[model samples]
Target: MNEVFARGPSLLTRLCIVLMLSVGAMVIDTKVDNLSTLRTYLTSLVSPLQYIADLPGGLLDWSASRFNSRQKMLEENSRLTNQITLMNEKLQRFVVLEDENNNLRELLDAPVREGMYRMIAELMAVDNNPYSHQIVINKGAIHGVYEGQPVLDDTGVVGQIVEVGTTNSRVLLISDITHAIPVRISRNNIRMIASGSGSLNELSLNHVVHSGDIQEGDLLISSGLGNIFPAGYPVATIINIVRDESLPFASITAKPSAQLDRIKYLLLLWPPDIAPVDALSPSDELTREGS
Candidate 1:
């Protein structure tokens, strides 16, 4: 131990020398600011190291705060959860309102039929029968919905109401096998019957001869023959035509213009002769009498 101490400066002497050197450096820095640039450079170089060294302490402090406050954390989580639920509900309502707005805009842009009054109705239920194309609407006799009343969308005729209850009505789609409409060729005004083929996308033009003027891509419009559907509304387009000498009638198929299976809202039309008369309540009658 004595030989090692003699080789280097004693521990007390080394400590005194370091203390004196530190005091001299601090006095020079305070008196003349000579070490300012050096101090700034050194701090800039050591800043990254200082941050790295403090990282563990900072992490420990963060963990203590984060895991220790169980009740407070639960309360904050619940508050955030409630806010999310409220936002979701608002988003749903916004979606519904946006759809309704679009439907109304389409209605406003549609051509108005002369002498026909229109009322909007919503679909309530769809018929599950794969063989039938029918839908039930929320409107009924109470809302002046009657049998044979025509149902139309923004594009064209959808169908006619076949059954009416007190608060609901059933509509037979134009694609139903039993349904038929008088449609005229929009190209030449040649009138014919368009019968449904029980297929959602197809209609049949019955009795069309081989020499008939109908051709593929010819548009069919309502001819207003049966007084059920109005004239000038688009109905279907001829998609296929097959003619054979053995068959008396040419086989013609048309695709409907209206999206019958995808429609969500419908318009119910009232003919001039079937205009609804509002039932007067007792108060309304008494007020009318007084007036």
Candidate 2:
């Protein structure tokens, strides 16, 4: 017992002394307010550890943003490329249309006989019949388009209006088998009749002799005798000529000067000699047919 109690003070006395020291330190900190600087120093010391803990998450967010930006740029680039390609195709078509417009303007500037007038119309539809080459134009009775009105392209005569509506009209191409036009030889003014052969590129001449002045490569133009088409318009070019002594007439074939299958725009002509009263009213005919 004596050895166990040999320490400087008993356990109870040592505990009381430690409590007193702790209370004295608390009082000094509260009354003097001297520990705030020490707390700031401690927080500064811990800041690097806090940053290290957050670094992984920050790096992950940055990487994801970078990837998304690259993907968006690629998509934008592809869209731009497609737009450029479409624009280029349209530009090519515009160039071709510009050239055609210039040629038609030249035709418009040419002097015509008194009281002759012209208007431009766009092709609205083409006939599906293989044997009949016909087209529809965007002009009708409302626009003064009447049956038998002459139609022309940039190069030459195209056809005549056969049926007219309020806003659209149908044309009977010169290449139709039932169609015929009076033409004359440009070299000698030798009059002949040109009939369509149900072929887009061929027209036949009627009652031509083997010894006639016409030959291959002769240019045929409208003679103005038919009272339909205007005079001096290019019609066709003679392509072939055959003669047989036993036959009364020579076989002659010519190609039309106008590109009927390729034209997109045409001119509707009004001739002075073709009195408006004499021309059939398309609206009246359509009404009769409908009835």
Candidate 3:
């Protein structure tokens, strides 16, 4: 037994000492209400070598709380920003609609007789043809716009839709070499064909005899002779006229009533009914012959 004691401690003796200490601590704690409060003093006195016992648990709880708080704040900020952006966009659209309605009301109240209705179309692209005054619009069959439909602006006739697609249409302006309008001299009611001279600002009055009564600065209005355009819309104003006695006809030039240089937006005239123009286009002959 003395030899066993000399070698530090036998295994049984160590186990018995640990069991006794646990029993003592439990008994003292159950008998005293302040045993838990006194545990820190007892631990420091009994074991002065433990320094990092509670550090891992404290660090884990602190990091978890910080992570949750940061995540919640980021989500709240994103939701608020999206809401503000949507509200601002809606407000801007409302303002634009109000302004457009007011302008239409004023035009209706004007003294001019307006048989033409308007459909707003945005100018999508401009063609680079110097010899032809033409542009494209961002509207087509999907928007109820079609080929041969007359287009106009606030002042006068812009052109007609020459090509149409599902979502876009091409406009041939009045100054194109192939475009023409049936107009009459405002002075004497004489009718003539105003043909485009392939210039941006000038159109020529062809087939007017040397003795015609049209003078410089005379206004030309659509006569509704052709079913293509509605009548009484201002088409052009004669800028210059030269009738040489030796020539068979007058050499006349007129500026388009519709501005041809720049068009950001324009209006399309909607006919009461889009009756088939089978008589206008030869391709419709197939339908007629088949029937």
Candidate 4:
């Protein structure tokens, strides 16, 4: 190594000499205004080399942009497909509404209910209890659904409002064991008490007269006995009446007028003013207190 060093300068001394010369040139270019033209010429000469150095990065960025666009297009297509499916479902529901309106108009002229107000509400949920037949409606006291207000549907009377919430209400159906509504024969207006039997589609008549002028297939409508439900709204139909000479009252069973198993929407009676007549009527109060 000493013989090599003696022959000439070492490799490290040669690198340091080259570095010192490059730094001295940079300092001279920056300090001397007369060499500005030389610096500009050098910059222009190396511009194309700088462009060559940046080419690979630009190409990679363009490929990445194209890949992102393909992914965005796929996501946009999926969103459009879901929106179209939802619109089609809404269109089919409109058709059902049109048919139901036509039927209601026909019955309007058949000497049915008059001067009655109704609002459409969706059935939000049904209670999971065997003892109580309660349902949740999307309408509430905010929408004029007061406590004890009558609830019905196109087929028949379903229940009455028991609990009114801010935006929803709970209804106790006539099938509940605790619910009772005053009813009577539409043929002769013989008043009686209709009690829930805990069955989905049945109500039992309490203290029905042996000759109450009711027969199988007879439509038992809301006779406005308590005046809570509007008069002439179908409540049930006489299905069976078992007479027992040994017992005081006959065993009566009636099928509900409404489609209890398949009810999706309901009509909430929203009158201008609700009167709690059933709660205050002498006969109804007496029956309740007695029970």
> Which candidate comes out best when scored by lDDT?
1
**What is model 4's C-alpha RMSD?**
15.5
Model 2 TM-score (2 dp)? 0.56
lDDT of each: 0.77, 0.76, 0.71, 0.71
Q: Against the hidden reference, what TM-scores do the models get? A: 0.56, 0.56, 0.55, 0.55
Q: RMSD per prediction, one decimal?
A: 16.4, 18.0, 15.9, 15.5
Q: What are the per-residue Cα lDDT tens digits for candidate 4 across 106-185?
A: 78767643344445577899998877799998977666668888887666778899899988999888889998877666
Off by over 4 Å in 3: 1-114, 275-291
Residue 52 CA displacement from its true place in model 1, Å: 32
Q: Which stretches of candidate 2 lie over 4 Å from their true place?
A: 1-112, 272-291
Q: Which residue pairs come into collision in candidate 2?
A: none
After superposition, the stretches of candidate 4 with alpha carbons farther than 4 Å from their true spots are 1-114, 273-291
Worst 10 residues of 4 by lDDT: 282-291
